[model samples]
Target: MSFPCSDQSIRPRKMQSASLPGVMEAVRCWCGDVCKVKEVTDFSDWLGMKFFMCANYESDPPESISTYVRPPSPPPLCMYYRWIDTEMPDWAVTEIRERGRRAWASLDLEERREKAEAEEKAEQKK
Candidate 1:
């Protein structure tokens, strides 16, 4: 599916609702912040695939106050990267670095809390 947006860079597409193994439920950064989902428009090979990237991925560093001063360096990347359109085997754990693993653990706790709340609400209605 396509969305009506002024930005010509992004081309959106419909994705399946079902969760895929090895695919994150919610894309997140190594710093435990959520990542943004982006669509590829320029790369012909990557077109139609949904990718996750750090929220600050494309941001530029702030400008210097003085003409002679150099701008401060950009913040370090969280290294949160993933492809939402593909699935991988469970053994793919080996591919995740320590930071990614920590982020995933945090994500797991969040998911568990959400599930428990949903179940509790369901039980209340019965």
Candidate 2:
């Protein structure tokens, strides 16, 4: 699935991240904010899909978020939405997926550590 782009002027800008060597930098939204990658893990079909959204969508004033869902409302969010898992170039998508996997692994490790600590505390109380 692809998000609607109302503004043709704003295009996706490729960027590079030094910390995430394999993953490419996030694309910039029409509103000039960097796009954020949202991980999809809800369904089997959409699992592992990383979609990009305007980083400013949830701003205090609710700026730049796409209103396309409701036409006749207002200008759609900044023209900066794409599926990195599918739309991105092959090489870039591969790197991005790898990065996502690594992130998930880190999170899993942290959760395990927390669980272990909680178990140890419970045992000490007994």
Candidate 3:
């Protein structure tokens, strides 16, 4: 019943900031340089973070920082990191290793025994 034309020039209003999802920020060591990265939460949960081992480090293990400098205006170091939307502000190399250890520990003697027994039974069935 209203007029056919509304203010066509004006754009629709956006939601208030109160409805925005949380933001994520962290420092990551990629290639050789450390940089900051940003992401948005509420989209997905972060599983874990992992650092990449630079391929160059194998053959040209830099004697010093200068030795690892980017070449001829080369792009920043090629380091890569796996980041997820989660709280891992204190994650370090050692922390990651500890996770691996704990995961292995979770499969202790009892679990191993059960697995072995199951395998033996399956073999008998065959």
What lDDT does each candidate get? 0.53, 0.57, 0.38
Look at candidate 2 and give me any clashing residue pairs: 66-77
Residue-level lDDT tens digits of model 2 in 33-68? 877776543323444456566775542223465666
Clashing pairs in 1: 1-14
Give, for candidate 1, the lowest lDDT window spanning 10 residues.
Answer: 1-10
- Name the lDDT value of residue 29 in candidate 1: 66
Error of 3 at 102 (Å): 0.5
For residue 71, what is the lDDT in candidate 1?
A: 53
Which digits, one per residue and each the tens of the lDDT, describe model 1 over residues 1-126?
222232324433332223333535665566677767764443243444566656655532244456468556655555445666553323333334554788999999999999999999999999
Query: What is candidate 1's CA lDDT for residue 79?
Result: 44
TM-scores, all candidates, are 0.36, 0.37, 0.22
TM-score of structure candidate 3: 0.22
